[model samples]
Target: MIIEKCNICPHACGGTRYEDKTEGSLCALPALPKILKSHLSKNIEPGLIGSKGSGQIVFAGTVLNDSECSVFDSESDNKKSRINGKKLAQMFLTLQKQGAANINLINPTAFAHLIMEALREQPLQIPVVYSSHGFDSLETLKQLDGLIDIYVPFYKYHHTQIAQKFAEAPDYPAKAQIALLEMYRQVGGLASNYKKGIEQGLLIRHRVFPDFSRESIAALHWLSHYLPEGTGLSLLTGNPYLAWGEEAKNKQPLKREFERVKTALQDLQMNVGYIQDRETGEFFYLDEI
Candidate 1:
């Protein structure tokens, strides 16, 4: 799949993603899909991971120009060979046969077109999880409406200053809000099966930074007001390694702030997902009211 002018992400770089070359593209990645790695793992949120495991496929590079707080920043290593749609489809099939609960595509916005190509050729029996940095284009997401089953997009920041400071995208909050709402519209709320685990849904992730607890609460407030009931959420612990500038200087232990955030979640009556322990590195699934 070759794009004359790539409008895959919110950046709208208008680059040419030819099969052979990437011209003027912000990501500078080939049009063809390049995968950094693939394996069945239980590293994700518990609701998504079944007894077997989730088929985790890490795509190389990203359309978003986020320098900090990118979950898959290490995947930027472009040494991996490019694979066609057919090869990609086969990988899904292989993982499914190996008893994977679902196929999770990480950092896939740049390769969204290629993924559509792969899915069209051969649809999977298991659910397809669309995980990204939450800077998606509406057009690109619309193209993937029926193809994706579960959406695990990150909601990084509520403030433009923090977004700009970290991601260099001042419009990150606006773009992410629109993108996430659309995702929920496509897949209303999280649906789990007794045996299959996460059958389909939208599970938004937000990493609570130490000093930015208020910002985190504000974002949660917006989500509680807009998103439908039973919508899944994952409150992650911010990675200190990614902190920079003022944020790095003022960073503190996440436990105290997280307690406040948890109290806020209860106050908002938005307790229906997972919360990662900053110290223990464990995910506490919250099904309690």
Candidate 2:
């Protein structure tokens, strides 16, 4: 949807489009033509694989807001959710028949629990990868842990940094990361550096921002060393030329960088996964059954 003045994200500035119903603000609304396309499917890197495609669901909004809260913008479609989490959960159950084993949720709000409850009605043995601005609590993770098979936390720009950029919420990043750390403890890994959870694991994402991968890489490094095991990761070396689509742009990195990260994972023998560095299989959208 083309939002005239979008405030759905950490960037609260209104640009003068029209009002968006999902965002409830003219700024966060979608422009025409941009609202018609809903054909979207993203490939998991070589690391975070499931036998079937990830079961994706787009809910209303987010719990975390940031300057880099570009998750919603990546989807070319206006994810005008079908109202509450109950319907959203039913939607996923339907997709399960079509080979959607995992999930990549967009704009999942605090009401995500409602969706989880839907799944819990008859729990999934499969994983549900959550894509959102970083920051989630252990309690929240525990609530979701029952319903989710895997946790994929997307770490956005730092809270302090997002505050500087959007000037809407300064503490978002900190709160989100704090939640992330708690999440790591619950399902990712423990603080003692020795504890490990029985659940699957987390696939931490670091999308290359603007013209750099420093912050993203640093996040990976820090996450990798923290647990006794390594953290599965996907480094989006490519950025969508468009300001918000950066995360979805799939670019191959230099052979050296690819090997370097690959080697580190090998060293740790971390239960790690990543997008393949090979250029041949760099397919982004395809219907696989």
Candidate 3:
């Protein structure tokens, strides 16, 4: 299953990735995995971080190449972080040994082929989670059917113009909708263990923008109507620093805005994950329904 012409992501840049040394892809990366870090973290979804913490593998590149992403801006030399699939498999084993609740793959869309190879080399004991940016191709996600146990993806935007304005991905909303539907079809609904947090299912996260509450509401409504009854939802307060360009510059949501969105989500009466306080780094979860 070597990728000769890379269609692993939505970009489908058609690079010769199997040739090892070639790097003509839009992500400017090879088929090899490039990891920034792999460690236990409690900063992720509350349901994912059990007693031992979620095993987070933050990959180096993104197909979207979002300018606001700190990882993309900070790393000057990505080649230094490159590792073979076998080594990535070893990292997974190490995390499992360290009592990680689940194997969380962050920003893995660009390296989907490489990750599949790694999983093949070393089958995971714990659930394999695909935490992505939501700009994914259905064909690529179909390849991960049996391999991925949980899908933690963002429903970033409901409006096509907003997606195109920020991420230069005009088709993001449509692609994300189809991809999420596929993810739900694969995993069904949320399943958890008392000791092991979330074991399997689709957990959708929507980051609330300062003046874009309508979009947020639209996303929530869509999830409520379309997804399964037990599907998990996380409403994250947007970070001003993570915003890019004049449209989002120095923008922060007012306290009242947060309250309004929170109240609307509570009204949904679904399984809410957590409402993060962007300023204080605190997490607030809704009482069990």
Candidate 4:
């Protein structure tokens, strides 16, 4: 299906994105993808990082207005560098040659059309990881059924008020729920190659907000109901760097809050990928927890 007006994301802003140099869209992107950076990184999920790290491609821009977004803090100008589908395919091939476990596409929802084109030009040998903000549309995800392998989506919020306040997307919670379900439907449950540290399945990452313990617990409960018994969950300690200029109310999570979230997750008895210590910033896995 041809996307004349960009409905790639859930926003459906209807901006004219067929032209190569078009602007005035929600993501401020052109038809071709603007590559921010591409590298093999060990900082990703422990399971995805084999002896050779996962090949990561950080795409420019976002559809959400997250107050605690780190992309803006790190990059001064995201629209400066650009690459077409063919070049992107070559980059994917290059990473595979260098022994990358999988090709991880960061913030790819905005450039989903171009990414699909790239894959068509050079079909990937390794698994394709779609690392997203969990605000994807079901139609777009259905189009990506056979292409994607691992779905690492960040389920940021379960409360509508919190989602609207921080992300300017009031319907985020509902959309995230449906999007995650579609992802699981496509990829099934978590399957791991422990010896190689390679995984092919759904790994949901949820960050515990400072004063949102209830919301965090609610999100966990929803996951427990819908997702498989041993779904991989990464409960991250919210990044202090992302909340730098935000309100004092939205600062780092408190010790008690962390304990509450940890206790709530423990009660669920799901597969906890990693949990960060509130004080020491240390990470513990399911067995350790």
Best by TM-score: 1
**Candidate 3 residue lDDT tens string, 1-289:** 2467788778787876642454567766666755788999888777788888999998876777454555443234645656788889999999999999899999888788778888999998898999998888999999999999999998888888888888888888888999999999999777644223788888887887687777788888888888878777777877767664557657766777777777778788765466677567576665452
Candidate 2: stretches off by over 4 Å: 1-42, 46-52, 63-81, 137-139, 166-169, 189-199, 241-271, 275-289
lDDT of 1 at 163: 85
Task: Give all candidates' CA lDDT scores.
Answer: 0.81, 0.47, 0.78, 0.78
Tell me the TM-score of each prediction against the true structure: 0.91, 0.61, 0.90, 0.91
Top lDDT model: 1
- Model 4, range 1-289, lDDT digits (tens) per residue? 2246788888888876643455457766567666777899888667777778989988876788885554732323644556778888999999999899899998888888888888888987888999998989899999998899889998988988988888888999999999999998998767544324546778898888687788889999999888876567878876766552366234678889988988888888875466766666665675577
Model 1: per-residue lDDT, tens digit, 61-151?
6665664435455444556677898999999999999999899998898889889988998888889999888989888899999999999
Q: In angstroms, give how far residue 98 of model 2 lies from its true place.
A: 1.8
Give the total clashing residue pairs for model 4: 0
Candidate 3: the clashing residue pairs are none
RMSD of each: 2.4, 8.2, 2.5, 2.6
Between 2 and 3, whose TM-score is larger?
3
Model 1 CA deviation exceeding 4 Å by range: 68-79, 192-196, 241-252
Per-residue CA lDDT of model 2 for 1-289, tens digit only, reads: 2334433333344554332334444234333212112222445553333455455665433333433444444323435333333445556666566666555564453334455656666455455656555555445556665565556666655436544454245665555566566556656631222122113566566554433344445555556556446455554444434133334344444556655554554454444444433345352211110
